[model samples]
Target: MLAEGPLEEAVEGLDVEIEWKPFELRAEPKATLRPEDPYLPEIWKRAVYPMARRLGVDITLPTVSPQPYTRLAFEGWQFAVEHGLGDAYNHRMFRAFFQESLDLGRLDVLVGLAEEIGLDGPAYRKALEDGTYYERHQDALRDAEAHRVQAVPTILVGDTRLEGVPSTAQLRKAVLDERARLAASVTVEGVVCRADGTGCA
Candidate 1:
């Protein structure tokens, strides 16, 4: 989604509500990833590589994986999302971890990132330390568990869940299909759009 902003552009004209829920992958927060997953090579080659190329992300496999906990970043993103930083922090974090290999598990690092995005650095640090937004992170985890989201980039479009990094075209099509489905369920007026996102779509 970060690559080229395709998802954002795809839905710009749809008037659809987009909700971002950030959470860690494991069953618990602040869990560490193993040094190696044997299938990482295949996934890197099959999915991540091609998607990065197609999206022009310039994404690279980390030379030295930080294996950092994303919980702090997810909690800190509450401020970013509220402040309208426009994904700057997310992009910065992505670059830090993937390209520059910065450790995300540090408070000072995250605070600096917040400051870079024009957010209140000290205040964000205070809030993070006070656990003010931990509940929100927990809520996100609960929602993720409820959705059975076992993959990264799981997007919920109506009743359908598109897991992993889905193509921009597929994301747009899902939005249209879900919109049509919801419109058809209306009692007073039933407006059915084409399934291909063509007319009335």
Candidate 2:
């Protein structure tokens, strides 16, 4: 997705929406903590952040919450990735929790971030606690599994699947191709209308 700027631009006028999908963060088997292991948060900052900005999408990683129906983990990831917030926010949260050793799963931290970004912190926090988006998250996870996405940063460009970090040229080509196909199928027309159901130019 990050690699296809040209393609996206080529089809900019067409009414189309790109959907991003994120992978689940399964807990690794317990092992002795290695100080030398690269921090997950830093890795994301260095790798995923820049590309995500270029792609103009967000990524979301849903952690287990105490809420009820608001557990839309997978869907949240998709939404985050689509909105380009996944890397920026998630990386920050992950760093706070894993590297800096802060509790990222806490409501206060999440709410703080929401506030910082001018999102509805209280509402979003409540949703997390209440599991308001749980179904969507679960559904997204199922979709990811069905698509065999076993890693982070998977790019789904139409029928083409590119996994891991892709080059700029590759991404650009994909975007262009996607736009071309969409443009080929749809045509725009102009129409004038009056409130009284009478049409005029």
Candidate 3:
């Protein structure tokens, strides 16, 4: 949601598919953030959180106890995307974590958001607790790693990978270029097929 420029223009005509990839937390070998620094949660609430809300829908917070299994949960969320549930949960979870400052790593928080969004809270919680989507989540993580997505807000524009929050112009250019490429690769008959059996029209 950390975006610049016209939102509609940035997303217009884009065949973008949203996925919530697992959050990877790697230890910073050279640390810069100190306890004296401003609280990131508060900062997010004041700035980034609001921006995210304006951008799209928010989703539920997960139960994060004992330790933060960010990778597992994020991958699970991404599986939801594969099954076409990304948009709904993404919007909810983002709001809860950034805007509401809720602990997204908790199951109760997740349940609350799910209930608010009219999802079956108990069923969803059971799924998470029982690791119902474990395999799917793992597969998503593998895919993300294969694509070298080490950061959030990574945009896969056709074969191009843009990491971090991209500018409106950059996103627009990517979208346009992708469209042009698709167009060029297509045939007038609208049934073009690749000799390698990779594409069809």
**lDDT agreement of model 3 with the native:** 0.59
Q: Which stretches of candidate 3 lie over 4 Å from their true place?
A: 3-8, 13-68, 71-85, 187-201
The TM-scores of all predictions, comma-separated, are 0.80, 0.53, 0.67
Colliding pairs, model 1: none
lDDT at 139, model 3: 75
lDDT of each: 0.75, 0.54, 0.59
User: Model 2: number of clashes?
Assistant: 37
User: Candidate 3 on 88-172: residue-level lDDT in tens?
Assistant: 7766766665456566556777777766766666777777888887777667657778988787667787897887666678878
- The lDDT-based order of candidates, best leading, equals 1, 3, 2
At residue 29, give the lDDT of candidate 1.
46
Comparing 1 and 3 by TM-score, which wins? 1
Q: Model 3: how far is 96 from its true place, Å?
A: 0.6
Tens digits of per-residue lDDT for model 1, 68-174: 77788888987687778737877787887777766787899889888987899998899899988889888988888898877777888888788776777888998
Model 1 lowest lDDT segment of ten: 186-195
